[model samples]
Target: MILESFDRRTIANLEAALERVCDGRPDGADHELRSFIADAMVACAKKGQTTLGALTEAGEAALARRGISDRKQA
Candidate 1:
């Protein structure tokens, strides 16, 4: 399971980043966005980005690449 693979702190950081990137989505649990967040977190963690700020930046960048603006939906 994902929980077994990563520590709680890492998971928390990723979750926070995911929330930021998913701010405008109809559903925070959207599969594609979740996948993107997971991928970005993994990539950033591998590069030693364990901090929330770094992970958030990475997540935001990933969203931007997919043309998913990180803003609240109307």
Candidate 2:
């Protein structure tokens, strides 16, 4: 479906944006930006804007790859 494709693209864009916001700093830069991304993700989830389980799993996997876990707890 066209909507499915759009959702996939939007999810990918959001993930990439989150990655860019997360890519450096031992202390971690940009809390506000990160929070904004998180909020956006939550909003998207609430609106059923994308596949929640897949998006969240992908995000968790990305965090794990970065040597981080418990992203929500972070």
TM-score, per-candidate, Cα-based:
0.72, 0.34
Specify the highest-TM-score model's number. Answer: 1
Top-lDDT candidate index: 1
Residue-wise lDDT of candidate 2 within 1-74, one digit each (tens)? 33453556665655665665467745346675465455555455546545545445444454454444345557
lDDT score, residue 60, model 1?
Answer: 76
Tens-digit per-residue lDDT, 1-74, candidate 1: 66776789988988888787788878657897789777987789778887889988898788776664555442
Pick out the ten consecutive residues of candidate 2 with the lowest summed lDDT. 61-70
Candidate 2's C-alpha runs over 4 A off are 1-6, 27-36, 41-74
Residue 27 error for model 2, in Å? 4.5
| RMSD per model, one decimal | 5.0, 10.1
